[model samples]
Target chain A: MQNTALLTVENLCVEIPTRRGILKPVDDVSLQIAPGEILGVVGESGAGKSMTGNAVIGLLDPPAHISGGQVLLNGKRVDNLPREQMRRVRGKQIGMVFQDPLTSLNPLLPIGDQLVETIQEHLPVSQREARDRAVAALDEVGIPAASSRIDSYPHEFSGGMRQRVVIALALCAEPDLVIADEPTTALDVSVQAQIISLLKKLCRERGTGVMLVTHDMGVIAEASDRVAVMYAGRLAEIGPVRQVLTDPQHPYTAGLMGSTPGASLGRRRLNQIPGTMPGLNAVPDGCAYHPRCPRAEAKCRAEPRPPVSGSASCWFPGEVKI
Target chain B: MSALVKIAGLTRIFDVSKPWLNRLLERRPKAFLKAVSDVDLQIEERTVYALVGESGSGKSTIGKVVVGLLAPSEGSVEIEGVDLHRETDAAKVDHVRSDIQMIFQSPFASLNPRWKVRDIIAEPVAARGGDTKGLSERLLEQVGLAAGDADKFPHEFSGGQRQRICIARALASNPKLIVCDEPTSALDVSVQAQVLNLMSDLQEDLGLTYLFITHDLTVVQHMADTVGVLYLGRLVEEAPRDALFERARHPYTQMLFEAAPRIDAFGREVDPPKGEIPDPINPPSGCAFHPRCPLAIERCTRERPEMRQLGPARVACHMAEP
Candidate 1:
C-alpha cells in the first residue's frame, strides 16, 4: 500500500495446468523492493528464483499462469495486464537480463542492431537516436571503445563483455526495475565480479532497483540491499541483506550461508540442507522445506502457510528470532 | 614426496573456423583460437592441485589433455613420472587412465540416465578390467549413498546424491589421481561442500591426488594444497594455497582477490574487479591480463612476463621480476 517500493509481489503463486493436475512453480511468495535497492532472490535451480523473476515481468510462457496474488510495479498492478500493455511495460518499465547472454543475444545480429531494436520496439525513438543511445549504453556498461565495437557480433565479445551488452540493453530503456536472472553465473570469478560491480554501479547511478536471482550467497551478501531467500516457490526468509546473510534466522538461510565458500569458517564441513527441493508438481503437504529440515515437527506438516516471523516456516524454528 | 602428475608446456588449439570452401564462399577469413596455450604444472601425491581461471582461460582444456580426452597441440604430460602424451604405452596408459578418473561439472550429463547408478559407478571398473562387483556396494557406501539407491535411475536422486554417485564412480577404479572439472559447480552449496569434504576425506583416507579445475575460488581455498592461476591459456602464478590466496603477488591475482565476492565479517566496502576479460583470440600482446590490469605498465604491453620465482611462490609478471 506504501508508495515507497518500486515493485512488490503479494502472495504470488504461479501454476500450470498439466494433464495430471495443477502444478505450482511459484507458491505463495511475497516481497518488496524499494527504488534504487537490490533485492537478492536466492535458491537452488528449481527454487523459483527465475520463475519469480519471469512472473514479475509477466513473461511466463504458455501453460504457466499467475493463478494467485498481485504484482505491483510503481503502485500499479502489472500482473495479468493486457498483452498489448505488457509489451509496452517489458524492456521499458521492468527489464530483464537472462542467465545466458549468448542465447538471449542474437548471434546473427550485431550488438548495435540488438540494442537499437529493443529501444525502437518500446520507445518512439528515431533510428539515429536509437543507434546513438545504443552505443552510449554499451559504453555505459564499461565496454571500452563501445562506439566502435557496437557493430561487432555477440561472438566477438567475451562472456563477461557479452553479459555487459545484455545489461546495456536492459538499462538502455532506463527501466525502473531490472530483473537479472543469474546474469553472471556463466562467467569466471573475476569476470563475475566485473559484471556484478558494473550492474551495481549502474543501479546506483540510475536509481534502478534490481532483483538478482542467484544461488551464490557471496553475491547476495555483496550486492543486495535486502535478501529474499526462497524455497519451493515460497519466501523462506526476507530481511535486510546484512542480517539475513550474516546472522541468518531461517535454517535454510543458515544452511546456505554455511555451504558458501566465503563464510570464513575453517574446517566446519559443508552441511547440506539434507534433501532436494520437491518437484513443482509434487510439492510437500505443508511447509515445502519441511521434508528437508532436520528440526521439523508434526505441526510443520499441518502448517500450510508460513508462520508470522522474519523468515521462517516451522513449528519449531531456529532461535535467531528475526 | 612424489608427484602423482606433472605437466609442462601443454596447449590445445581449436580450429573453430569454417572449412576452406565455406570460408571462401562466404569471403570470411580463416582463424584459429588457442584455447589452451603452453603451460606447466605439478601435482603432488595425495594432494589436490587446483587450476583456477575464467572461461577461455584454458583450465578445462588442461583437464581434457590430462585425461587423454583431447590431445594437446604441444608439450608433455607425465602421469606418475611416465610420459603419456609422447606415446601411449598401452599397458602404462591403461594403468594411468585407471588411476586417473574424471568427475565432470554436470552430474546429470556425466552420468547415463538409461543406466542404473550401480552400472554408472561400475562402468569405470569394467573399463579398466578391474573387479566391478567387489567394489560396487562398498564404493557407494563410502560416498554416503545407500546400496539400495544404486538400483534407481539418475533422475530419481537429488543433486547431492548424484554428485555422490559421481565420486563413487571416480573411486570405483581405485584411482590415485582424480581430475575433478567443476565437479561441484552444478550442485547446491551444501551439496558442493559435502562433495568437497568427501573428496578431502577420500584423499586423506585413500591417498588420492586431485587436479581440481574450477572457477569458484572458494572451493579451491578449501581443497587445494597448491593453486595455479591461468589467464588466456597461460599460467600467471603458482604457489602454495595459503600463499596464493593470502598474498597473491600478480596484479591479476590481487585484482581477483578483490573481485571475488567474500563474506564480509567487518562489513567493509567491496570493490570487485573493474574491467571485463578481453577477447581470447586477440588477447593482449604482453600479459594476457594486462588489458584489465590496473597496474599494467608499458613493458607489460610490449613484452610478455616470464614465470619466475619470487620468494617461495612462482609468478609470471614484469612487476614480479627481482
Candidate 2:
C-alpha cells in the first residue's frame, strides 16, 4: 500500500524575510503521503503546519516563499513550477479546504455555480456535465436533497453543510491530493466528526491523498493513517498513527499524546511541556524544542540531531528516562 | 456542598426580525430566535460544572447569563441565595457581580492588545475601586507566569501565556466563581492541557466554583466534576463526570461521545451523525435532537421529554430508562 508515494515533501523550507532577519517558519521538514492515505500534521500555533500545507499547494503569500527543497506530487515537481503553470495545477492536482467555510466560499455566487465552475475549470467538461458532477459531489459529501440544495447560496447552508459544499467544490475538480487546513476547527464537535468522516470516506473511495493539518491530537489520531508531529518549524516525529500515538519515539510526541485530554483519562495532571515555543526570530541554536524538553541534556543543546533510528528526530528517542 | 449558583427556567429570546418598513417591503413576518430555553442548573460550591454542547446549543448563552454578561429574558439567576436579576440592594448585587468573572474563548481577542500584562490583570480589581498595586504580579506568579512578565504587553506573549494572563485577570477580583466559555478551544493540545491543569489547581487552592462551557466532550470529562449536555437551547443530560462519560443516558449525549475523535480509539471508523442541527430559529416539533438521534421514536417528534432522574444522571429523553 505504501509502495508508491502520492505526495512527497523533501526538506521543504519556507522563509519569511522580516525586518530583523530571515525567519524560517518551516525549516527542513520532510514527509510523504501514499495514495488514499491521510498524513495528519499536528503542531502548535507557530509550528509551521499550515505553512507546510501552503507551500505544497503553492499558495504562500508574498514575503513568505519556499526557499529550499521540492514538493513532488506523484513523481512531478510542482514547487519549482512557474506561477501560471502552478496555478493550473493547484485546483487540478491539489485541492484546498480551509478552516472557515464562509471565507473559502464566495458569498455572491451560488454553491452550484462554484462547484460547476471548479469542475469545468479543471476538467474539459461541458456545462451540463459539470452540473451533474457538482450534484454527485454534493451527494457524496452527504448533503441532503443535493439537487435542490445545489441552487442554494453559501449562506443558505448551515456551517457543516457549507463545509460540505466547500469540500464538494474542492473535490469536484478531481484533484489527486487535498490539503485541508483545520477543516473542522470552525465547526461544532458533532459537526466536526461529520466533516472528518466525510473527508476520510470521500478521499479513500477516490484513492486521493490528504494532508490534514490541525492542532488537535484527537482529530489526528482518529483521522490519519500516518501521523507527523511538528514543533518550531521542524518534524519531531512521523510514523504509523497507532505507533506514534501509543509509543511515541520523540519526547515532543510523547508529551503531546500525554497532554491530550482524550488520552490522559485517569491522570490527575497532564505532563506539561515547560516554557513556550520560541518565536521565529529567537529560535534556538540546536534543537528547537530542547529548551522546554524535560529530557534535555548537554549533548542535545550542543549539536543538531537528525531523524533518529526510526521515525523521530531527537538525540534520545523513545520514552524519556528521568 | 452548598449551591454557589442556581439557575431556574432560564430563557433568552432575540428578536431577529426585520424592521416594520423592511418587513412590509419584503412581505415577511416577525421572527424571534430562542437562544436559551428553560435551562436549569445548580452549580455546587468549589466544583466544576461543565456545559457541553455544539454551536447554537445555548451553552455560551447560559454562561453569559450566569456571569451577568447577558440577562435572561425569563428565569432567575441566584448566586449565594440572592437573585442577581431581582435583587434591588446595591451591595447584594455588587457582591454577586464581583464574585463572578468570565473568561472568553479567544485569548487574543479577550485581552486588550495595547495594555501591558500588569494593567490587564489589574483592570478587574481597579474596576471595583480597589488598589491595583502589585496585585497583577502576585496573580501572575499564581498562574505559573513569571513576575517580570507583568511589564510585557499581551502581544509579547504566546497564545498559552496570554491565556495564563487571562486566568490571572479572572483571579484578580478574588471571585468565588468564574464562567469560562470555551477557554481552551483556541489553544494547542499541549497548551490546552497546561491551562486545564492550572485551572484545576486554582479550583482546589482558591475554592472556586466554575461554570465551564465547551463543546469538547473529552475536555468535559477531564475538567468537570459534573457535566451537562445541551442541544438546541435545552439541557439534554446532566450527571457526575464518571456516570455521564461511562453511562451516558440521552441518545444525544451518546452521539456526542461517539462523534468526538479520541486518541485511544485510533483508526476506528466513526458513524457520523445523520443530520445537521435543525435551525435554532425554527427548531423541530418536540425534542430538538430528534431529527439527528439514532434512537428517536415517533413519540420523540410528537412531545418534548422533560428531564427525569435515570440511574446516576438526569436525562431528557423518552427512550432512556430509569
Candidate 3:
C-alpha cells in the first residue's frame, strides 16, 4: 500500500512547546493515500486530525513544529524542504481547502483573479490562458455562468457558492494531492451534500489523492475509500471504509460508529463511550483511550501505549463485537 | 395526550434594509428577511419535536420564539393552555414563562468565562428568585460532571464538559420544555455521542419535553419523536420521525435525505443538489424551494404550496403524490 502511495506520512509527530510543557498534538500517526483515493481522517477536536493535515502540508503555525515525521509526495521527501521550497511544493503539488471558504479566499480580489493568479503562479500558462482555465475550472466545479460570475468578489457569492469557488481554486492547478479539512462543515445540510459530491467528482475525475479531515462520519463513509480513526493524537484504526465502519477493530472506532445515529439505525439510545478523550497534558500513561474504552483491562491501563500493529493500535483489537 | 406547546401562524420578520439615509439615497425600498414564516406545530408533553433545516431555514428563529427570547411578528405561542404573548393575565404569563429553558450552540461563547460553573448553573434559578441552594452540585452530577468541579471556572472544562455545564444550567430552572439548538454540533463525534446520550437519559428520567433544533438528520432521527423539515423559514414537511424517514413526500424533504451524508449509504453517488438556496429576502415567486427543487413545475413557480396531508406526512409541494 505504501509503495504506490501518492502521499505517505510515517510516524508523524507534531509538538507545541507550551508554557506548562511540550504538547504533542499529532503523535506517531501514519497513513497513506493512493492516486485517485480519498483517505478520510476522522477524530474529535484535539485528536490532532487537523494538526496532522497542517503538518503534512508544512503549514504548521509557529511554536507548533513537526518534531518527528517523514512526509513523502510521490516518493520524494518534502517534510525537510526549505521554507521557499516548501511554499513551492504547496498549491503547486498539494492543494489545500480549509474549513472556512471566506478565510481561504482573499476578500479584496475577484474570484477570477485569485484563480488566475494561483494558476499562473504554479503552472506555465500565459495571463489569457490562466484566465480561460480559471473560468473552465469554475464551470467544472458546477458554478453557473462561470465567465460572468468569476468577476464577482468572494463576498458576493453565497456560502455554498464560495465553497465551490474554493474547490475550483484548489483544483485549478491540477495538483496531485488535495488536503480538505472540514470543507463542508460550515455550510447547511443540503449544501453539504452538494459540496461533498462536487469534491468527490472532481478528485475521482483527476485521479487526485485526497486527505479529507472531518469529524463527521457520514462524510467519511460517503466519500472516503479508506478511513483513519484518531483518538488522543494516535491512530486508533486504519482500514477500508466499509470494514472499519461495519466491523471496527478498535473500541474507539466502534464507539464512534455507534455514537453516530445513522450507524445505530433502530437503537433507541446512542452507544456512548463513558469518558471524554484526554487533554494533551494528561494523556494516560498506557493506552490514551483506555480511560474511555469499555474493554480496557489491567494491561491496557498499566502497559505502554500499544503501537499500530496490523490495522489498529489496541491491546485487544477486534475483541469487542460492534 | 395533550399538546404542551402549540405554535400557530408563527412568523418573525427582520428589517435587513440598509440605513435610512443609504436606502433613501440609493432609491431602494426597505428590505425584510422573513425568518420564520407561517409555521404551525404542536409538541406533546414528554416528547421530542425536532426542527431540521439548512443554515437559513429559520429553525433557530423558531427555537428563539418558543423560548420567549424573540417575539413573533404574527402568531400566538401557547404553552399548556395559555397564550404567552397575547394573554392578558400577568400571573398566567409568568407561570408559563417558568416552564421554558434553552441550550444554545457553541458552549465556549455561551458560558461566562469569569464565573464559576456553580454560579453559571445557578443563574437561571437565582434570576427567578428561587432558592438555588446546592442546585448546581446536584445538576452537575446528574449531567455526568463531578459535584466538586462546580467551583471551577467555565474555561477549566473542555468543550464537551462545558456543554454538560450548559445542560446542567438549562435543567436548573426545572423547566418542562428544553430548546436545544445544535447542542452537540461543535463537539467531536465521540463527545457528541456522550452529550446526546446524557440528553436522552435526562429526558427519560425527568419526562421532559424537547424542541430540538439541528441541521443534522442523523441527530434528529435519534432524538426526535416528530420531525419538521424547514426550508427558507417555512415548514415544508412535518411527520412522525419514522414515517418521515421512510417516505418523505415533499421534494425538498427527499432532497434533504439524499443530500444528507449517511453512514449506511457508503460510497453512494449523490446527485449534486440542483441549485443553491434562493435568497430568502427575495425568494423565488412561489415555492421558496422551486429553484433548487428537482420536481418543481410551472405551478410551483407561480403559487406557493400550502401544507397538505399526504399518507403519513404533511407535505408542502404541489407535485407530491396524493
Candidate 4:
C-alpha cells in the first residue's frame, strides 16, 4: 500500500516537553494518501488531528517536534529535510489550507500579488505568466469575475469568497498533495458544499492527494475515500469511509458516530460517551480510550492495545453494546 | 401545553454605515442592514424550535431578540402572552425577564476567566438576591459534572466541561426559555452529544423551551421539534422537523438539506449549491434567494413570495409545489 501511495506517514510521533512532564500529542499515527485520493483525519479538539498534519508538513512549532517515525512523499523521506530545503518542498510539492482563511492570507498585499509571488517562487514562471495563471486559478475555484476580484483585498470578499481565494492560493503551485485542515468549517453550509466540491474536483483533475482534517463526520462521508479516527493522540480506527461510517469497529469510533446528532436519525437521545477524552499528560494505561470505552475491561485498563494492525486498535473491536 | 414563547413580525435593522464625516466626504447616505425581517414563529411548551440559516442570514439576531438581549426595531416578543418589551408593569417585565436565559456559542469567551465556577453558575440567582446556597453544586451535578468542580476556575475545565458550566449557569435561574446560539458548535462530537443529551433530559425534567439557533442542519434535525429555514433575514420555510427533512418544500430549504453532508450519503455526488448569499446591506430587489435559486424565474426576481401553506409546511417561494 505504501509503494503506490503519494504520501505515507509511518508511526509518526510529535511531543511537546512541559515543565510538569512531556506530552505526546501525536503517538504512533500511520496513514497514507494515494494519487487522487482523500484520507480524512478526524477527532475531537485535543485528539491531535491537526498536530499530525502539522508534523507531516514540517510546520510543527518549536517545543513540539517530531520525535519519531518518518513522513515520505512519493517514497522519498521529507521529514528530515533541513529548514530551507523543507520550505521549498512545502510550496513546490505540498500545499496547505488552514481553518481560517483570513489568517492564511496577507492583509496588506492584494491577493493577486500573493498568488503571483508564490507561483514565481516555486514554478519558474515569469511575472506576467504567473499573473495570468493566478487569474485562471481564481476563476477555476468559482470566484466570479476573477480578473477584477484578483486585486481585491481579503476583507473585501465575503467569508465564502475569501475561502475560495485561499483554496486558489493553495492550488496555484499545483502541488502533488494538499493538506486541508478544517477547510470549510468556518463557512456556511451552502458555501461549504461549494468548497468541498471544488476541492474534490481540483484534486481529482490534478491527481493531487489530499489529507482533509476535520471534526465533521458529514464532510468525511461526502469527500473522503478513507477515514482515520483518532483518540487521545493515537489512531483508534482507519478504513474505507463507508465501512467506518456504517460499521465502526473501535468503541471510540462507534461512540463518536452515535453521539453526532445527524449521523443517524430517530433516536430520542444521542449515545453519548460517558467521560471526556483524557488529557495528554493523563492518558490512561493500556488503551487511551479505555476510560471512556463502554467495552473496556481489566485487560484494556492494565496494558496498551497493540499497534493498529487491522482496521481498529482494540482488544474487543466491534463488540461495543449499543 | 400552550406556546411558551411567541414572536411576531420581528424585524431588526442595524446601522452599518460609515461615520457621518466619512459619509459626507464619500458622498454617501446612511446605510442599514436588515438583520431580521418580518419573521414569525412560536415554541410550544417543553419543545425545541430551531432557527437555521447561514451566518449573515440573521438567525443569531433572532435569538438575541427573543432572549431580550436585543430589542426588536419592529414587532413584538411575548413569553407566555406577556410582551416583555412593552409591558407597562416593571415587576411583570422583571418576572418575565427572569424566565429567559441565553447560552452563547463560544464557552471560552462567554465565561469569566477570573470567576470560580460556583460564582459563575450562581450569578443569575445571586444577582436577584435569591438563595444561592448549594445551587452551583447541585446544578453542576445535574449537568453531569462533579459537585467539587464548582470551586475550580473555568480554565481548569475542558471545552465540554466549560459548556456544562455554561449550561449550569443557564439553569441557575430555572428559566423556562433558553436561547442556545450554537451551544454545541464549539464542542467535539462526543462532547457535543453529552451536552445535547443533557439539554434534552433537562428540558424533559424541567419543561424548558429552547430557542435553538444553529447553522448545522444535522443538529437542527436532531434537536428541533420544529424547524425554521431562514435566508437573508426572511423565514423561507417552517415545518415540523421530520416533515422538513423528509421532503423540504422551498428551493432554498431543499438546497440546504441537499448541501448538508450526511453519514448515509457516502459517495453521493451533490450538485453544489449555486451562488453565494447576496449581500444583506444591498439585498436583491425581490426574493433574496432568487440569485441562487435553480428554479428562479422572472416572477421570482420581481416579487417577494409570502409564506403560504403547502402540505404541512409554510413555504415562501414562488416555485414551491403544492
Q: Report the number of the highest-TM-score candidate.
A: 4
lDDT of 4 by residue, A240-293 (tens): 999988898888888888888886588989998898888899988899998887
Give stretches of model 1 more than 4 Å off: A314-322, B13-18, B22-32, B87-89, B265-275
Note the Cα lDDT for every prediction shown: 0.84, 0.89, 0.91, 0.91
Tens-digit lDDT string for candidate 2 (B12-72): 9999998999999999999999999998889999999999988888999898888887888
User: If scored against the real structure, what TM-score would every candidate get?
Assistant: 0.93, 0.97, 0.98, 0.98
Candidate 2 segments exceeding 4 Å error: A1-3
**Candidate 4 lDDT, tens digit per residue, B1-322?**
7998888999999999999999999999999999999998888988899999988889999998888889999999999788878989998988988999999999999999999999999999999999999999999999999999988999999898899999999999989999999999988888888889899999999989999999998889889999999999999999999999889989999898889888778877889988888889999988999888889999988899999999999999988986
Candidate 1 lDDT, A169-266, residue by residue in tens:
99888899999999988887877877887888888888999999998888887888888888877888888888777677677777777767667446
Candidate 3 chain A, run of 10 with poorest lDDT? A268-277
> Model 1: per-residue lDDT, tens digit, B34-151?
8877788888888889999877788998999898889878888888777776755788766777788899898878789899888888998787576777576788899987888878
User: Alpha carbon lDDT of residue A199, candidate 4?
Assistant: 91
iRMSD of all candidate structures: 2.4, 1.1, 1.1, 0.8
Docking quality tier of candidate 4? high
Q: RMSD for each model, in Å, please? A: 2.7, 1.7, 1.4, 1.3
B-chain TM-scores per prediction: 0.95, 0.98, 0.98, 0.98
Query: Which portions of model 3 miss their true places by more than 4 Å?
Result: none
In candidate 3 chain B, what residue range of length 10 has the lowest lDDT sum? B270-279
TM-score winner, 1 or 4 = 4
